[model samples]
Target: MASAVLDHDPPPKHLDEDEDNDCPIEQVRLTVPTTDDPSQPCLTIRTWILGIVGCVLLAFVNQFFSYRSNQLSISSVCVQILALPIGRWMARVLPPTIIRIPLLNWSFSLNPGPFTMKEHVLVTIIASSGSGGNYAVGIVTIVKAFYHRGINTMAAMLLTQTTQVTIFTPLNPPLKKKQFLICFFFLRSPVAGIRLGRIVQEILGGFSVHVCDSIQCRALNEEERRPKGGLSRLQFFLISLGCSFAYYIVPNYLFPAIGSVSVLCLIWKNSIPIQQIGSGLRGLGVGAFAIDWATATSWLQSPIAAPPFVLVNVLAGYVILIYILMPLCYWTNIYHARRFTFLTSHLFERGGAPYDLDRILDAESFSLDVRQYESYSDIYMSTFFAISYGIGFATLTATLSHVFLFDGQYMLKLWRQATSKANEKFLDVHGRMMKANYAAVPQWWFLVILVSMTALSIYACEGFGGALQLPYWGILLAIAMALFFTLPIGIIGATTNTFPGLNIITEMVIGYILPGQPMANVVFKTYGYISMSQAITFLSDFKLGHYMKIPPKSMFVAQLVGAVIANACYFGTAWWLLTSVPNICETDLLPPDTPWTCPSDSVFFSASIIWGVVGPYRMFGPGSIYVSLNYFFLIGLLAPVPVYVFHRLFPEKKWIRLINFPVIFGATGMMPPAKAINYNSWFVVGFTFNYWVFKRHKQWWGRYAYVLSAALDAGTSFMAVVAFFALGNYDIYAVNWWGGVLDDYCPLANCPTEAGAYIPNGCPQIQ
Candidate 1:
C-alpha cells in the first residue's frame, strides 16, 4: 500500500506554455520548486521528532518574549535554522525498520532515506506553527496581569488547547476509508447494501492508488529546480547568528547609553555644542540597532525580497511617510502632538489622564454603567493616535483601490478559472503535485470545526462570568464578519504579503453592537478577526507544503499535532512566567530596567477600553474634536484613484506605477509600539541590503540575503531566551556604566509641556 501511494512518474521537463503564459506574472515567476528530487522522503520518524522538539522550543520562547517592551517574536527563521541539522542527524542515527499498521494495510520505513528538503521544510513549518505568541495568551495576560483576576492554569491550558486544536482540524483530511466502509456495511436492504458496497469499494480503491500515475513526473537539473544565487543552509545560519549576537550585545550591554538620545535634552544641558553632538551620535546608534532588528526578518519575507527596484519603492514609501513626514508633523505640532507623551492605543481623558474605566464600571457585572459613564468628562486621544485612525482608514481604502486597479482582472480571471470545471488544470509544478498526490480537506470537516468552536466560544463566554459573558448572537455576528472578509483579505495577503488588519473594523462593528460591554466587544472582535486570519495562515502553510512536495495528509497531521504541542507549551510557559516573574505587567512594582513590561497586553487592554467601554460614538461622533477624522476613510478611498488612472493613461511611464499609496499610508501608524528609531534604522538596513546589495551584487544578495535574515532572527531570539532565564531573572546587572544603561539617553524624548499635562518619567523639568 505504501509503495503504491509513493509511486510516481518523473516530473514534466517543460511546463505547458499556454498555461504558463496565462498565469499571473507574480505566480508564474515565483512558483519555482525548491528541488526536483522525486525520491525525497517527506513523512518520516526523524521529521516527526525534530518537528515536535522545535515546536515546543519555539512555543516557549515566543510566549516568554510576548511580555517584553520591545515586542520581539521568535521568528520562523529560528526553526528553519535549527531543524536542518537535527533532521539530518536523526536520519543518520534512527533505525530504518518498515512498520506496517495491522488493519490499515499501510507500511512505511521509520527513517525512510536521507533527510530530504521536503522533510526539512515540513519540520520547519511545524516548528514555526508552535513558535510565535498565540492570541489565546492575551486572555491569560490581561485577566491575571491587568484585571488582577485569578485563573486556573489547568483550565486555561485546556481551553487554549481546545481552541487551537479545533481551529487547525479543518485543514486535515476526512476520516479514513475503513471507517466509512464499516458504516456502509450496516445497510439492511440487500439492494441498498450492494449499491453502497460498490461505491465504498470504488472510493477505497481510489484512495489506494497514486494520483501521479496518469501524469509524467520528470526530474529537472539543479538550475531548473532552484532559483539561481542562493546560499546553503549552514552559511546563512552561522552568519546570521554572529550578526544577531553582535546586535544584541552592543546596544543592550556594551553601549546601552547610546541606544536613545534626545535633541531637547542635549540642548538643555547648559548650551554645550558638544552635548548636542553627543545626542546626535546617541540617536544614530539607537536608530541603527532598531533598523537592524526590525528589517532583518521582514526584508527576507517581503514580496519584493528578490527584486531590488520593487524593494526600493517600498523603502522609499517607508522613509518618506514614516521617517520624514511623521517627524515633520510632530515638530510642527500638527493636531497638537506636543500635548501627548506617546501616540499609543491607550485611552485618555480630556485632561490627558489615563481614562479610568473602573470609575464607571458596574461593580458586580464589570459592564459599563451608562449613568456613571455620563458623569465622567469627555475622552480624548493624542494627535499621533488621531492620525493613526486616519491612516488606518486611508490604508484600507487605498489597498482596495490598488488591488482593484492593478490586480482586479487577474483576480477575477483566477476566481473564474478556479470555479470552472472545464479549465481546471494544474498551472504550476506545485499545483500538479497537489492534484497528483493528495485529496483536499473535505468541506464537512470545516463545518464541524466551525460549529464546535462556535459552541465552545459561547460556553466560555457565558458559562464563566470572568470570561466576558458575550451573547450567542454577538458570536454569530463575529463569525459572519470572518466569513465576509476572509476571501478579500486572504487574496491580498497571499499576493502582497500585507494583511489590512480587521482589528479596527471588527472593534468598531462590535463596539456599536454591544456598547459599554468592554469584555463582550473584545471577545467578539477576537473571534471575528483571529478566525479568518488563522484560516488564511493554515491555507498558506498547506500551500507551502504543496510547493515543497509534501503529501497533503502528512501536512495536515503535522499542523494538527504541532498546534496541540504549541498550545500546551505556550500555556505552561505563560503560567510559569506569570508566577515566577516578580511584579509582571506592573511598572511600579518592578525595577525600571525590567523587560517584562507587557507592552502588547497593555495595548490590548487599552484597545478594549477605547473600542469596548467608552465606544467610538462618544469619541469620534458628531460635535467631537475628532469627528473630522471619519472623513479620512473617503479620502483614503479616493487617494489611489488618480495614481491608478495615471498609470493606465501612460503605461510607458514606469515611474507612475512605482507609487504604492497603501504602503506609504500604512507606514504612518508605525509608532508607539514601534518608535522613530525603528523606522529610521529599518530604512537604512533595507536600503543597504534590498537596494545597494541587491542591485550591485545580485549573486551575493540572492545567495546570502534570506539566510542572513534567518540567522539573525534565530540568534537574537535564542540569546534573548537564554539571557532572561540565565541572568535577567537573577537581577544581575551588566556593569552599571553609561554605555550599559537602559534609557534611550533621551530625557526629554516625550516632549513634556510647561503645564505638566504630558509629563512622562525621566523628562527634565523646564524651569
Candidate 2:
C-alpha cells in the first residue's frame, strides 16, 4: 500500500542553478526535503513514552512561567531539542521485537531501524502541543486574586477542561462533512462511515495516523534522489543546546540590566557617564538575547514558517517606525507622549494617576452602574494606550483588505480545486500516506463530544454563582462568532505569522449586547475569542504532523493524552503558586523586587473593566474623548488601498508586497508587557541573522540557524524554570549586588515627567 502510494507521483525535478536566487517560497520548496523515508519506524512504545514525559515537563514549565513578571513561555522547540536524543537512544537500546495484533492484522516494532527524523518530529510535536499554557487557568487566578471568590480545585479543573474541550464542538460539523465525503468515496461502503467517523473525530481532536505523510513523502524522495550533506540531527541538536547554555547566563543572572537601557539617560548623565553607559549596554545585550530567544521558537522554525525577506521587511518597518518615528513623536510630545509612559496599555487620568475601575463599577455586583459612572470625573488614557486602540482597530481593517487584495486569486483557485475533481492533484505526500494507511475519524464521535461539552459548559456557567451566569443564547453567540472569524484569522496567521485579534471585536460586540454585565461580557469574549484561537492552534499542529508523516491515529492519541496531562498539571501548578505565594499578584504587598506579578492576568482583568464594565459606547462613542479614535477603522480600511494600487501600477516592485501594515502597527503597543529595549534588540538580531547571515551564507543559514534558535529558546526556558523552583519561588536572592537586582538602572525609562523635571517619584532630573 505504501509502495502504491509512492507510485502515484513521479520523482520531483532537480532545481536549476539559479533556483537559490528565486522567491523564498520557491527556494524553500526546492531546498528542503518534503517527505520522510517511509520504511523507517514511526509509531513505537519509545515514542509514546518520550512523548508523555516531554509533555508533562513542558506543561509544568509553561504553567510555572505564566505567573512570572517577565512572562517567559516555554516554546515547543524545547521538546524538539530534548526528544531528539531520547529517540536516538531508544532506537539503540530498545529490543527490536515486532508485535503483531491478532484480529486487527497490524504489526509494529518496539524499535524502528533508526529513530527517523519523522518520528523525532512527531514526538516533539506531541510534547509541544501540551506546552501551550492553558488560558482557563487564568479564570481561577483572577477569581481568587481580584474578585476574592474561591472556587474549589475540582470545579476549577472541570471549568478549564470543559472550556478547552468545548472549543472542539464548533469545529466538528465542517470537518465531519469533509471527512465523510472522502471516506465514503475511498472505502466504497456507507457502513464504514461509522468507523471512519471515529477516525475523523480522533483527527479533529488532535490524533492522527498519517497526518504528516504527504510532506514527508516528498522529503524522503528528495533525500533518495539527491543526498545533500549537512550536520547530523544529533550534532545539530547538541550544538544548539550548547550555545543556548552558554548564552543563558548573560541575560538571566549575570547581567539582568542588559534587557533594557535608557539610552537618553546614559548620554545625559555627566557624572556617571561610564557607569550609565555600561548599564545601558547590558540592557542592549539582554535585549538581543531575548530577541534571539523569542525568534528561534516562532520565526526560525521551518524556513517556510516565515520567509527571510518577510522577516527583513518586518525588521525594517519596526526599526523605522518604533526607533525613529516613535521616538520623534515622544520627544515632540505628539499625542502627549511625554506626559505618560512611552508605551503602556494602561489607561491613566490627566494627572498621571492610574485609572481606577472601582469608581465605575457597582460595589456589590462588580458590574457597571451607569449613574455612578456618570457622576465620576472624566477618565483619561496614556497616549500610547489610546493610540493602541486606534492601531488595533486599524490592524483589523488593513489585515482584511491586504488578504483580500493579495491572496484573493490564489484562495479562489484553491477553493475551486478543492470543490472540483482536480483536488487529487493538490494532495501532498502526507495526504497520500493518510489515504493509504489510516481510516478516517467518524463524524458521530465529534457530535458526541460537541453535545456533551456544550451541556457541561452551560451547566457550569448557569449553576455556579461565582462563575459568569451567561445565558444559553450568549454561549451560542460565542460559538457563532468563533466559527465566523476562525478562517480569516487562520489565513493571516498561516501566511503572515500575524493574528489580528478577535478579542477586541468580540468584547465590543458582547459589551453592546449585554451592557452592565461585565462578568458575562468577559465570559462571552473568552468563549468567542480564545476558543477560536485554540481551534486554529490545534489545526496548525495537525498540519505540522502532516508535514512530518506521523500517522493520523497516533497523532490523535498523543494530543488527547497531552491535553489531559496538561489540564491536570496546569491546575495543580496554579493552585500551588496561589497558595504558597502571599499577596500572589499584588505588586504593592510583595517586595518591590518580587517577580510574582501576574502581568497577563492583570491585562486580562483590566480589559474586562474597560470593555465590559464601562462599555465601548461610553468610552469611544459620541461626546467621548476617544470618539475620534473610532475613525481609525475607516483609516485602516483605506490604509491598504493605496499600497494595493501602487503594486498594480508597478508589478515589479516586490518590496510593496512585503509591507505588512498590520504587523508594523501591531508591534507598536507592546510596551508594558514588553519594553522598548526588546524591540530595538529584536531588530538588531533580526537584521544580523535573517538579513546578513541568510543572504551571505544560504546553506549554513538553512541548516544551523533554526537549530540554533531552538537551542537558545530551550536552554533559557529550562534554566529559567529551574531557577524559579530552585530560587525564585523561595524568594531567595543570589546576591544584593547591582547585577542581582532588577533593572532599576532605567528608572526614568517610563517616567511621565519631562526630562529636566522631577516630581518626587525618585527619578533623576536631567542636568
Candidate 3:
C-alpha cells in the first residue's frame, strides 16, 4: 500500500566486468578512507544551506510573478522556471556534455539527466506527490468534508472511476504512462551524485579527478545506464493501446466479469493467502455496494435494502480503521528505519556483490547513525499511544511539530558516516571538499533556457487542445512550493510533502477560480497530480542516495533534470493534447464525468475548508483526540495480534514471530493502501499477497519478488506509453457528448452546464 513513488530504488552495481562497455557501474568502486577530525567542515551542509536560502528567494520571485496580477495563480509556472536556474546549479554534479554551437561554445551537465540516482529520485518524488498524494488527499478530504456522509463522496468518486474506462479512455493511457515512467525511471536510473559529487569534491579540494576503466568506478553499469529499457518502453506502448481498446469496447462487456477475475488473478499471483485476501475483499465489497445502495436508500428515506446510515457508519469505520491503523502502523516501520538505524545493510538488502554488512553496520568503523533518536526505545514505541500523546499535545500549538523530531547531531553523524562509506567505496580517499569544477552560468543564460523550454511545453499542451486550458504556471508553482516546503521536512507525511491534503487544496483552488468548467478542472488537476507524482519519485531516489552514501547535492540536481525530461517527452505533449483535443468522447472510449468535470464543486469547497482548516485542528482542540485515540489503539492492536495469531496457528515458540509485529506497522505505514491498491478489493488482495510472499516465502520471495514487482511495473509503464501514442488513442475519439446531447435540448439558447447534458444551470451565451 506504500506509494511506489516514495520507495527508494536500489543502487545499481553490475557484476559483469566488461571493459568495452560504457556502464557507469563499471567505474564505481567501493573503498573506505581514513576518517578525519570531526571539527572539519561538511560540504554537504554548506551546499544545502546555500541551496535552501537561494531557493526561498527563488520561490518569492516566482510568487511575485505568478500572484502579481493573475488571480488564477501563475505562481506554479514560475516555480518551474525558477527550477531551471537551480537545475543549472545542480548540473555541476553531472558529467559535462559539450555541444558545438557554431560560434558559441555550449556545455551542459547531464548530472540529473540520462542515468543517474538523482534522476531517479526526482521522478520518484514527483510521482509520489501525484499518485500517493492524490489518493491520500482524496480520502482525507472525503473523510473530513463528508464525515457524516463521506461514504457518498467516496462512492461517488469510485463510481466516477468506474466510468473512467468509458469516459476518459484517451486520457487514461497518458496518465498511466506518466505514472509508469516516473516509477520506471526511479527503479532503473543508476548512480549519479556520488561520482559527480566526488568530482566536485576533488575540484573544491584541488584533488585530481580521474577517469578509470575499473569495474568499481562510481557510475551506472551498461545494463542500467539507459534511462529507458527497450522492454519497458515497449510495455508502455502496449498498455496504452490495450487500455484504449479496452476502454473503447471492452468496459461494458469486460468490467462485469473480467474485472473481478483480473483482480483475483493479480491477488493470487501476488502471494497473498486466500483468507486475508477474502477479508479485505469482503470489506471492499461491503464498502462499494453500501455506498451506492446508501445513496439510493436515502432518497427522502425511500428504502433501498438497508438503511443508508448503517452503510455510512460501517463504511466509514472500515475506511477510518484502514487509513488510521494500517498506514499508521506501517509508518512505524518507516519511522523506525528513519529514527534508529540498526544498520542500513540489515534493513535494506540491495544485492549485486553484497557490500560487507559488517563494514556498513559497524558503529566504530563507519558513522552509520543519522538523525539521532533519543533511543531505540523511542523508535520502537513510536506507535506507543501514551508517549506520542504527550508529544502530540505539545505539537498542538504548531501544525509542523512532531513528537519524535530527529536530533540534528544525529543526522550530522549519519551524514558523515554515509559520506565516509561512499568515499571509501567509490573514491578511495576521504577529506575531499565539495566544490563545483565548472563555472556558474550567467543569469540570462539560465533565463533563456527556461523561457525556451516553458514556451515549447506551453505550445505542445495548448496548440492542440483548444478546450482544456492546462495551468502551466500552476505546475511551476507547485514544484517551487514542494522544493521550498518539503526539503526540510524530509521523511514526514505519507511520502515527503506530496501529501494528498496539499494537492486537494490545489484542486480546490482550481475549482474556486474556474468553477463549472470540467475541462479546465481536469487539466488543472493533472498539473497538481503530475507535480506531486514526480516529487515523491525524486524523493525516493534521494532516499536511495542516502542508503548508498551518494552525495545529496548531486542527487538534487539529477532529480531536476529527470523531471525536465519526463515533462518534455512523456507528459508535456500528451497532457497538452488531452486538454486541446475535444473529440475523445465520440469513440465511446471514456466516460463524460471526470473529477475535473464532475459536479463536485461543493465537495471541493468543503475539502478546502476541512483539510485546510478543520483537519488541521487535530494539532489542537478536540481534533487531537483522533490522533491520540488512534495511536493508543494501534499499539494495543499491534502488540497482541502478532503473538495471538502466530501462537494460535503454530502453537510453538510464537514469540519468535512476536518480534515481527513492528514490521507490520512499518510495512503498513511505508505502504499506504491508497497508492498501492487501485480499489478496495486490490487493497485486500495486496495485503494478503504481501504477507504471504514476504512472511511465508522469505527465502525465495524475499530475493526475487521485489525484482519481479519492479520488473512488472517497468514493463507495464513502458508498454503504456507506446500503445497510447502510437495508436493515437487520445485522438481516435471525436465526440462531444455534453455539447451534442444538450445543445438543442429544450434548455436555454446557450447554457454553461458543468459536464453532463442535464440543465444544472440556466443557459448562457453559447461561446
Off by over 4 Å in 2: 1-43, 95-118, 167-233, 269-306, 316-339, 420-433, 669-671, 754-760, 763-767
TM-score-based ranking: 1, 2, 3
- Mind giving the per-residue lDDT tens digits that candidate 1 earns over 270-295? 43222222332222122234323622
- TM-score, each model? 0.81, 0.80, 0.35
Ranking by lDDT: 2, 1, 3
How do the residues 343-425 of candidate 2 rate in per-residue lDDT, one tens digit apiece? 55666655556667667777667677788667764566655556667777877777677768876775566555444554455
- For candidate 3, give the lDDT: 0.28
Q: State the lDDT at 649 in candidate 1.
A: 95
Better of 2 and 3 by lDDT: 2
Model-by-model lDDT, in order? 0.58, 0.58, 0.28
Tell me how far the alpha carbon of residue 452 in candidate 1 is from the true structure, in angstroms, after superposition: 2.9
Alpha-carbon RMSD, candidate 3: 22.4
Backbone clash pairs in model 1 (N, Cα, C under 3 Å; residues 3+ apart or in different chains), count: 9
lDDT of 1 at 361: 74
